[model samples]
Target: MHRKALLTLLKEHHPVTADEKAMTQATIEFVEANPACFERTLLIGHITASALIVSPDRQQVVLIHHRKLDRWLQPGGHADGDPDSRAVAFREAEEETGLTSLKLVSPAILDVDIHPIPARGDVPEHLHYDIRFLFEADPTEPFKLNEEVKDVQWVALNTITTRTNSVSVLRMVQKIN
Candidate 1:
């Protein structure tokens, strides 16, 4: 049931924004069309999972200064061979930020994004059909930095609004608010 939660969200919720509507439809279509989409070996495009981790009080979000992208973004990565998107999100969050106490806000997807990733090493440019899930992490917990990101910090919600400008990121924020 890789798509059960996501299909439920798209079918039940009337998205407020055009971006949300489009992304939801796209995700449904993509999943319905390709059963092997969970594999990163699918060069055409693959499912990338991301975790939008917010503080328990909902005032701040944890973002990583992605070493590759050179920008502040949520903690996430490719699904590899995993068919479970939620598991992918949690694993990536822990691996990227070392937050063992992180908890998922919900099993349902918070957002879906389709973005192009530039070629890295021998990998060709491809689309990342990112399925994002909301999560909560302790603001007081000491974060252990990893090689995946240059820096990690808790950012105020307003700062995310002003800086990230990503539709999916903002939508995740809206989900909590």
Candidate 2:
């Protein structure tokens, strides 16, 4: 969507303070004006989020091995006009993983990472600003993998860094302590 139109939609749906609104608007403008800038620029430019579904004892986390990317990642996607990015994160996690009984904690903003989309054979390059958020789920809840993921498993925290996850995902795990 165009920057101005997005800004207008955001304002109409999820009103924020003048300063916050301006900042969000500016980011939308910058992203629309220079799509390439997304690859390098980090921060709040693109407000996306991920759900870090930590185990009850905080010893492990749920992760999805994305089919297309072939890398493990926390479940999440674009906010898509949702005012609460945390909600977006949780929703995506549930939808993608088929675990509906998860619960978010006190809404901790874990960390943010910007990375380029892998070069699909025919797709243009894009970028994602992954705003990670911490959440918790009952350890016994049954999980069903969805097609968006090639595999889904709960991995120990120590094993996370050893996997083929992005460096950003590792960094998010580091912040858990």
Candidate 3:
């Protein structure tokens, strides 16, 4: 049922760029081909969910310094066996950022990305079909960082480049603008 919901979301997603279009197609194909796409045990790759959390006024975005990756990124994580990407995104964001007043910007998917995660410990390198959602939260709300992240900050949208040079992050900023 969750897979079907994702399919419907992809169908209505209307990607914002050619790269996103390609990623959307790849995600559809991957999800369709793998029944256990939500399971991290699928060493080849697996589905992940993320939240592009923005300030209530939309001028700033919440970024987390991922402990393991040693880089700044949006709040997100593995779906485990849960297929509801929307819920996963919200849950991961709340857990990672400790923002209690998060509001879903929309029910629609904000973006889709397929990126490779490097091998770590016993885990092999694999692709992450990341489903992203837009969310709004009060930037003034103090965030309690969890073990998954080192720090959390509200970055001005114009100065996002200082945090990370991820192409996907820039693309999302463009979409927001």
Candidate 4:
């Protein structure tokens, strides 16, 4: 059921950039070929969900300082067997940022990304086929940090590059602009 929904979402999604267009196609193909794509055990790569959370006013974005990656990034994590990417994105955003008032900007996917995760412990290097959603929340909300992240901050949308140079991040920023 999840696989079918994801395939439908991918089919309806219209990517905003040439790079994202390619990634979306690749993600669709990957999902079609891998029934276990929602599981992290799919060592080659797996589906992940992310939230690009913007302030209610749209001037700032919520970013987290990831402990493992050691970079300021949007709140996200593995699907962990869940196929509802929108729900996953919302859950991760709340878990990572401790913000309770988050509202989905749309039911449609905000972005799609495929990036490599370095080998760690028992896990080998693999790609993260990320499906992202847009959310809006109060930047003034109190935060509770989980062990997975070092810190969380509300960053100006225009200054995102100062935090991380991730092409995917920049692309999402551009999409909202």
Candidate 5:
């Protein structure tokens, strides 16, 4: 779960897009070049873990209305020095959605994204090298809202495109098998 581990995953993953390929390489370089890459102390950018969680039957996905970004996104958060991205993904999913029955569909990296986090308070704008994994949540379990999101819902997989225009969500949807 350390930087080395993430770097290894990046090097081995077969990225689907040119952007993803570039981002994967960039993340590997970043992890090697910056000792603080695993820690949030890296002001310019840092590693984050996320989960593209789907219902047990794979008919729907769980999305949160992110409070800071005002966007509906999969559950994820800063690693906060945690080397285990898989654990981070699981922890964040449960914390954000209150669904403890979730299980990782696979530990492999499903997606890699580098996005900017707008400045907040004294923290200047920074990039998040988000590492995403596929997960499945028990359809029978209910979820409760957390502080990070205004609301949480299970949206139909087929209707995700109409509900939101997020490429990450759409991309993950297509990859869900």
Candidate 6:
């Protein structure tokens, strides 16, 4: 989406708080002032969401072993112009994991995690502002892994912390417990 269009949408949907407005404005100005920055980035500067999908038993969490990153990550992706981050998180989670019976919790789990994208082939580094949500699903929900993922599993939360998962994923587990 164009930077101006995104800003206008944000203004209309985002909480009309001073800080939020200022941040939105600043982001717009940055993009406008530095087109090169936008070109270099993989994902445009906009809101995005992800989900930490937990089982009904709450003992395990759905995770994807990302082939590109080679680490366990929650199912999520860009908002794709969706103003509602929670809906974005849910959509991506369902699409990537193929779990349709998931339920999003009210007072949606929220967090901001920024990470640098590794240099891939000729693409340079970029960053993602991951807004995460917590969701619940039946313990036996069927899963069909997408090609974007190397593997998917319902891993015990404790096991995730022991492995080399991203700090954001680890922090998510900590927050839930």
Question: Worst lDDT window (10 residues) for model 1?
Answer: 5-14
Model 5, position 27, has a per-residue lDDT of 84
lDDT of 1 by residue, 1-177 (tens): 765654565466456678778866887788678777888777878888999999989999998889998878899999887877789999999999988889998877777778889998988998888888889988988888888789889999977865588766777788778
lDDT of 5 by residue, 39-132 (tens): 8888999999999899878899999889989989999999998888888889999999999888889879999888889999989999999999
24-73, model 6: which lDDT tens digit per residue? 45555554565343233434344557899888777888888877788778
Writing each residue's lDDT as its tens digit, candidate 3 over 59-141 gives 99999999999999999999999989989999999999999999999999999999999999999999999999999998889
Q: After superposition, how far is residue 147 of candidate 3 from its true place, in Å?
A: 0.5
* Model 6 lDDT-worst window of ten: 35-44
Winner of 1 and 3 under lDDT: 3
User: What TM-scores do the predictions have?
Assistant: 0.88, 0.71, 0.97, 0.97, 0.95, 0.72
> Who is ahead in lDDT, 1 or 6?
1
The residue-by-residue lDDT of candidate 4 on 5-59, one tens digit each, is: 9999988999998989999999999999999999999999999999999987789
- Which ranges in model 2 have alpha carbons more than 4 Å from their true place? 1-46, 119-123
lDDT of each: 0.82, 0.67, 0.92, 0.92, 0.86, 0.67
Q: Estimate, for each residue in 1-177, the C-alpha lDDT of model 2 and write its tens digit.
A: 333433343334321235434544554555467533323333324556689888878898888888877778889876665546667888889987788778887554565555667645655565665556788887688888888888778889988777645766776676666
Candidate 3 residue pairs in clash (backbone atoms < 3 Å)? none
Please report the TM-score between candidate 1 and the true structure: 0.88
The stretch of ten residues in a row with the least summed lDDT in candidate 4 is 168-177
Error of 6 at 165 (Å): 3.6
Predicted structure 3, TM vs. truth = 0.97
lDDT measured at residue 165 in model 3 versus the true structure, 0 to 100: 98
RMSD of 4: 0.8
